[model samples]
Target: MRRNQRQAALVCVTNQYSCERLILAGKNLALSEGLELKVLCVQPPEYASGSYLAEIEYLFAVSRRAGAEMIVYYRDDPVRAAVTFIHANRIAHIVLGGVPDPAGSAF
Candidate 1:
């Protein structure tokens, strides 16, 4: 794919240890669709210090190993930040973790 292509699979995550799965899911989806893979972490400014920093660094390394670049955004509203990133990056697909429901919902 060309470097200037806008379509990408965006994996959005919080400060959770289970984010590796999300990153891999995004990578697989991007591969299948011939799109770029991207990982995004949105956190508040309060969590910018201490252990959170270390966890972010680890996750960044994981993202790189998966052939994706991780982007970190410190914002008061995570949803807003994710939306901004989705638009700015021209994300075609989003990989997010949530509670599984027996009644499936449309994407």
Candidate 2:
């Protein structure tokens, strides 16, 4: 990130298909506002055994195509990490996906 450019971020903390829309939206917003797009994905501890490695790779590819610089953080709380990253990057805006119901099995 340069001093003259603004930055927007997309937080995709889960291994779900819905992140595509976030990436797309972030890309569009960044382009429209002349901001750099940054993407973050945090892998939870349960998936540290490489169960979802392939899906992570797919996400990396998708984010790259969307012109976002993607970063994958391992073994951390997704929400907290997202906030930390956003603050560190001095991001002006953030794009995120819809959260599933807390009572349901997903996260």
Candidate 3:
């Protein structure tokens, strides 16, 4: 990011579906304001069912349509990766999904 440029929003979407939702919201925000969106996705094990790649492609499409940049990462430490992205991109704000509590299924 340049010094005279406006900061972009860093969105941490948990899954492919959530990424779509976040992209929509981010686009709306960007449209209302003079800012861009930086969509970021983080997943455990980095790859699962090839969904990560699909999500990245989806994000890219959304970003291209919205005139924004997409940054997706599949890693073990999602939060850390997101933080790194935020710092690297000089993101102004962070939009994140809720984290579910750790629990087991009933017998």
Best by TM-score: 1
**Deviation in Å, model 2, residue 101 alpha carbon:** 9.6
Q: In candidate 1, which residue pairs get closer than 3 Å at backbone N, Cα or C atoms, i.e. clash?
A: none
Backbone clashes for every candidate come to: 0, 0, 0
The better candidate by TM-score, 1 or 2, is 1
lDDT of 3: 0.69
Q: Deviation in angstroms for 102 in model 3?
A: 17
Order of models, best TM-score first: 1, 2, 3
lDDT per residue, candidate 1, 47-98, as tens digits?
8775587778888988999899899988899889888777677688999898
lDDT of each structure? 0.85, 0.76, 0.69
Q: lDDT (0-100) at residue 102 of candidate 1?
A: 68
Give the per-residue lDDT digits (tens) of candidate 2, residues 1-107.
35565656554546766677778888888888887788888887878788888877787888889887898877567779777777678597777677578889775
The most accurate candidate by lDDT is 1
Model 2 segments more than 4 A misplaced: 1-6, 99-107
| Candidate 3: tens digits of C-alpha lDDT, residues 4-93 | 767787666665655676777777776676677777767777475574676567777876786777655667887798777776666777
Q: After best superposition, candidate 2 residue 1: deviation in angstroms? A: 9.6
